[model samples]
Target chain A: MVDIAAELKRPKIDAHCHVRAGREEELSSQRLVEAGEMLGITEYWCSRPITARYGSLEEIRAGNDAVLAAMRRYPQRIRGLCFVVPGYYREACAEIERCLDAGMIGVKLYHQYKINDPAVWPVIELCTQRRVPILVHAGYVTDPRTKAEQPRLSHGADFAEVSQRFPETMFIMAHIGGGGDWEWTLRALRDSSPNVYVDVSGSNLDDGQVEFAVAELGAQRVLFGTDGTMAGCVGKVIGASLTEEQRHLIFWGNAERLLAAQGKQPLAKIESGQEGVAG
Target chain B: MIFDINAWVGSWPFRSLRDSTPQQLTERLRKAGVAGAAVSQIEAILHRNAQPANERLAESVEPYRDVFVPMATINPTYARWEDDLRICHEELGMKGVRLFPEYHGYEIDGPLAKRVVAACRERGLPVQIPHRIEDMRQRHHLDPARGVPLAAIAGLVAAYPDTPIIVTNARGIAQSPLWRRTELRDAAWYADTSLAEVYFQGLDKDLALIVEESGGRHLLFGTHAPFSYPEAALVKRATLPADADTLEEISYRGAMRLGLTPESWAVKAGSA
Candidate 1:
């Protein structure tokens, strides 16, 4: 019998997540970690919450600083993703170096510029040299409301283009469900190079989405994420028709590979005897 | 045992759904720990006349009658829908009705909708209105149905205070102005937890907050299955910060009070 309850309690990594520092917001950082922990999410690969402004260096630094603080507050539960805007190529590259030096495992890019834009190439190249994955803000916003709000949002086509240009760099397309038009996004991702992976996260709990992503992108290219909605995030994967191996890959195995490739380690081992690292 | 108040059968044109047949739906529900579900037909939303869809739903679920409670959909805008409602209630033995105001192109507070609600009230059957079938942002471009706002549902509730209204696939109820109103609180209405969430995009909103806002009385356990994963609601229910009584109420009691009885025979030997 498939012990689904035990599977739900397995130590999983949420690849795309956000937390707020207690500075401007309340102790939402603590709440995000607690909520994920309650659902057996052992680690959060998180960045500061996305904002409307991605053009300012000060804002970029502020976001990364918040993530650093969250990492310090929950050293065992949180792993930092350095947030940066690639429009400032030189400064963006420098920030990547600073964050990686400070122990962040990956880079998070938002919608100031498309991932394929020439402005972002240097940042991609920097991450490639540093052996860290770039978690790019991706969505195919077809609806008027999201379109108007995220006119510059990156889509699967952008990832396809960027991934091909920099074949050596690994790219994670953020939030297949969070992005508008998931079906369209999945179709677009079919042409993306193998380096482009998609995270199954967001509040839209539509059935068959996780299975569809695994089918379209292949199981190895899919990662589990909450994007803030923890239960829905975990549930969509559990609800989908997947084998134990596919579930493990999406839940933690693929994340383990990514973390290992980046030469990072979880601050604490999983107490459930489900070691996050495959040693 | 969890009783899912919202579920569907039939093919959705935009996307292919898994486990949508009556037999398939039961297995899906069982895997998610749901003992029974009140199911509606998806084709009714798109069909100009819903009687055929209702007939299909009744026939499809005939084999698995104990595990599935057939809920008919009647587009009041269609001609002679009262007769269809009568056939569904009297002949088909459907427990209740589900309406699609946005897809059927009728206002929630319009005369046609009122007739449906009034008739259901007279029959002592609850009316379930799905706030949306598909998420608006990701819906097929050709499909232009918008979500029925909470205010419109609230308007219907105010007009027919005695009618039992169950709103499924609803979002942002806790944040809406109608939340916690005396009429909503006191009425025999409920909102299912299929689409409810604890947090989204860094906001402290969704299910847990909704339960806190409503004091857990107005919530029901729902999966929106086949269209949505049953595990979504199941996980949300598992994480609710409620005591045993409140959890029981949300899980099955609220559904029971709505006149939905989980067939005792459907429970496995050791479950009860």
Candidate 2:
């Protein structure tokens, strides 16, 4: 058996993580960083889960504040994303400015409105002008419950439409494995420009899913993301049918390139001596 | 040695997959420390009649009897499904039979299904139901196949409490409330780990919960290989928080309920 703990020591970055401040059941900054250290994750790009927990504008601000606070607390290990409810256009834009002013690198959008809805155009345009990537919640609409809750939730086709409309904006389709028709989503995005990328996160670990993503989008277009767990994300990449270089790209290299594009530097690198330490 | 209850052989037309042939698959499994797998053919799920593909599967695994246990697919919708089951048990000596109700365009509670279930019970053969052959989202664009409904499967399990019934490729059902149903929990029904991954808050809580609720004896280790990487399942298995004995039960012992024994597989002399 592969020593997963040992394999995790290789420097990596989790591009998609949720920080639940004040919620002990959820991950705190200290716990998140500690988990990252054990799993070889050098940095985490975080958004606040509180925004989704409570949908009011005040709660949304609180969520963004939590991300900012976590980033401040763990400057070396945490990166912040400005969480916005696109329906509240002005407040959303203001929050984006506040996060960017505070050195947050990107934007994280949830299911407040459809990805392609006209109301979200301003936020997309702002992020495009700022040259920051927007990580959108694009999951499969499987059952009645999900369909009812997120009637306008973005799928692969919707994401494709959004990416096409704003070619300059970099959009990360969150959860390529999140229970919606991923195959349809992948195929829909197959011909999409390089501006569109995917995050390998979410709860579903269907076999060959990572490989399928890599095959369809190429390693460069796929970024390693753990919807908030190192073990979940790390295992998918580590257990994939990938070479050392491909694994490195998914684990850290691809994320590094994305972060570097935003003028951010990883806090640390996996030293050559650290390779295969646990193995 | 891991025993994968949900491995497959044969090409998938929808997407390109590695390790399709028996040799490629076994080499892949062996590298991941998989000692054996109960495998079926992908063609069985795609074809109108699954008998030809079933025969091919038996023939393909004949050369590697020690590692690959052939599980034949019988489409009850087909006219010759009874003969197919007989050939699988009497002729090929297959201990398990897989049914693809959705792919075959039939419901699990249909009269045909009742007949098939009765036959398997009479013959002392285990019936395996694959809830979803491919992630419905990733299935061939033109082929609009979906998984067998969880309720339908529960009804069938309720009807035949005495027969050994294993559900494979059921990632969604395992996470649902139905997984904890008293009727299912009381019956001789088992679930394969092919689609049972649960990643939440840095913990594999779904797997832990399933093992806790169903008991380790009701879970079987499955990779859904060729369609999925064997290493993925092995990695999940390794990370399961269960003790060594419980892990042993999930990996191999649970499968013994289907009447498989280590001695039943004949490893050729000098074979790796």
Candidate 3:
């Protein structure tokens, strides 16, 4: 069998990750970097951790502060995503501006509101104007047994609806393999505009999930991410039945290109002092 | 050589799976360096009468006994389940029996399930319970049932301590509190790596930890083949941070404890 960890020596970037402070244990920046080093990850684009309840504007600011601090502490190993709870539109817009001014590259939306909810339009419009990507928490509906009374989750179709409305904005359907409706998610994103991409994050490792995504949406549209565990994410891609070129594209190239398109530099090139190819 | 404890033949009702036929499956497994696999029939999970599926599985693997070990599925929900178990053990010569209580609409700890377990114990046959064949979330729109509950499995484990019970297709079972319970931890309950793989940082420490917790002898290597790429599971096993002897135990010896010996079971179909 191929030694995937040994063979993959290129600089890789995690397009989806979180940096948290306070009670959260696993989402700390130190933990993310420690885990990243094990999987040969060069950099990570991180968002703030969201709680089960709707966080106040002050809570969102504190989360973004942790992200910005991580980017500052590990200048070349971390990038920031200003997390927003779009229902607090005025406060979310202000926080987005504050983080973007601090050199953060994108926006991260959690389950505070649905993707298609009209309340999120201002944030979507802001992302489009700035050419930054938005990684949204989207998944299939819960099983009837575990279904909550008022589930405010977003599905693939919801992402499609938002992506169509904001054609210029790059929308990442986080965790295409997440939840029961991943197949439905992939199909919904297949015909949507090129601005939409899928991240291979989350805990669900269904067989042939990555291959199916690559086959349907093309390798360029799939980005590698570890919702947390670096080894699990790397194993998912490396153990997949993909060509070396396809593996490279998913592991690093696609992320590099996506960041570049947003006028952002991956920490690897910045740390190596390489020429600004994108610029 | 890797001996895969979980693999399937025939079509799944939900999605299109590659390598469904015996030739295709064995070839795929062989290419991935898997020496042999214990295969069950997909129809058994969906069909009301598991006898035909078991017979079909035996016939399908008759020619390839050198590489395929048939594991007959016995749904306790069906009538004459004991007779089915008899046929599976005597007529079909299957090395073990597999059950899908959730899919078949029977409780794992119910009387019918107990009878099936008793029969397998009497025959010295191992019982393989698939927590689920497909991810509950990813099941076909029509099939809404979830995987067999861990509590039911725990009850069954407590009920039958001597029966070699192997759980297949259970992802993340290692981290569950049930895995740590004294009743389950001390029992001869085993798990396959098909869905139990967990990785942190750059190491496959989750699998290694599972081996340590379950005793290296209690964990078996399985691919959940056809539904998953055979190489995926093989890569996980090969990459695990374990010593050669421990790896050997997980790859083959663990199943040997369940009486699935390649020497006895894999000698070209009829000559044995």
Candidate 4:
């Protein structure tokens, strides 16, 4: 027997998985535990959803707190981020400050909330001053334009602008900056502020674009992540191309530095295939 | 073992034929470390007459007989389908039959399809019916497969019960409602993992898991023949590695029980 699990056991660090503790319709907690076990990934974070009426400040607090609570319950395995609509900087700023001080490591901006908008300035300013990383939904030009109204999974250009505006905050250019095209993404990354980093979060195929990011911006800019709940179809074709070295970086290396710089222990460092060790 | 169970052999007509000759297909497979491959003709999928396509497919494949075992496509709608089948087995030396039910305007449950299936079984060949050729939303509109009815095909499996049927070009099994029915379950049908996971939905075990749970054997592999980067399938297959026994069953043993002779099946045909 060729030990298939070994063939797949390079380890994974899901830098941007959705942290939906209260929602069962999508990725439930029980399913997350099992899936984490199966894919050999122990850490992931979910972004909070932006809403229609946008809930009350307390309601927003609960949403952020709920993800923190879930991570607390499984402290040895998960990481989390508090999501805020970029359009509501007042409530988003308060939530970001509260969550960051409480030990939440990152910030998430999602659907319909344009990164280019002026309202997101407060949160961006706080992230820059505090050095908290932000993962925005950056999509390609050809994708449904409405994703901007929903969830923009790729936001490189806006990230560039924001990264330039806020030098201290580390911006993760997620999904290889627009559905895995290195050439175009490179132009965006190269043009962006040096603070911008690309996360191989959802798409882990290690395309030359990823190499391009590493080549142009250095490997420290590359982070590993899985869209977790929907790591199929996308992961299948793309995962095939990832080499073991890239897996190590995306899984935990970049994440470790990000956390250590923030004065926190990296999530259950299982490197050397050990029970627990430094990542 | 990870194998591309559904790739093509020669140049495909819808797009372009494979970039390589038959020997090139073998060389390509070898580069991926694949021991053997079960290959079909891409040109046969869309060419109105299966003769020229079949003829070129057979001739191109002759030199690499050991590594490239052929599965001839017999369009039940083609003028000389029976002749194609005969030339495939007796003349070209194929060990299986592939069907394009949707493209040919015939149902898998139709009488001509049964005749074709019977001809294949008599000659100890496994029948291959692909569910689709191109991505439904991505096809160029000039040549699009009408798409087969998965339920009707399931019905055919229920009727046959004992016959071996392999569905290639298999994708979107998750979206199919027929397999979800609690009242009906067909144990005889199987599928190849082509166009299976283009969505990154973690649907790797989706169809196979369903088939396996339903007491069905869903053969897992890729469809790389004539594809631009045929090695693309190899990357997809790597995400899905079966255990030794499961690999034995899918990569060869199970196909043998379907009536594929020892001369053509992957495991038996080569040291791989």
lDDT of 2 at B181: 67
Compute the lDDT of residue A153 as modeled in candidate 3: 71
lDDT score at residue A9, model 4, on the 0-100 scale: 44
Which residue pairs show backbone clashes in model 2? Answer: A140-A180, A181-B137
lDDT score, residue B134, model 4? 49
Candidate 1 lDDT by residue in tens digits, A123-207: 9889998889999888887678877777789888888877888887889999888847787778887777887899998878889
Give per-residue CA lDDT, model 4, range B85-135, as digits (tens).
898889887778888877777778889888887777677677777776643
Task: Provide backbone clash counts, one per model.
Answer: 1, 2, 1, 33
* Candidate 1 lDDT score at position A229: 71
Off by over 4 Å in 1: A1-4, A21-26, A271-279, B180-183, B199-205, B213-216, B262-272
Q: Give one digit per residue, the lDDT tens place, for model 3 in B1-272.
A: 67899989998877878788999888777766787889989988888998898999999999987778889899888788888888888888899989888778878889878888888888999988988776665556677547887777778888898788888877666565447566667777888877665454322345657766555756888878888656556656755657888887888877766767555543432352
Candidate maximizing TM-score: 1
The better candidate by DockQ, 1 or 2, is: 1
Order the numbered candidates by lDDT, best leading: 1, 3, 2, 4
Candidate 2 per-residue C-alpha lDDT over A1-279 given as tens digits, one digit per residue, 9 for 90 to 100: 555546755677788988875554245677677666566677888887432332887887788788888888888888898988887889889989998999899999888777889999999999998888899888775555556666766877777887788987889998776656676678788657677889888655655778778888888888888785345456677778787777777877777777777787666755654544321
- Between candidates 1 and 3, name the one with more favorable TM-score: 1
Worst 10 residues of 2 chain B by lDDT: B261-270
Model 1, residue B148: displacement in angstroms? 1.1
Question: Sort by DockQ, best first: what order?
Answer: 1, 3, 2, 4
**Per-prediction TM-score:** 0.93, 0.82, 0.88, 0.71
Q: What C-alpha lDDT do the candidate models reach, one value each?
A: 0.81, 0.75, 0.76, 0.59
Q: What is the C-alpha RMSD of each candidate to the true structure, in Å?
A: 2.8, 4.5, 4.4, 5.9
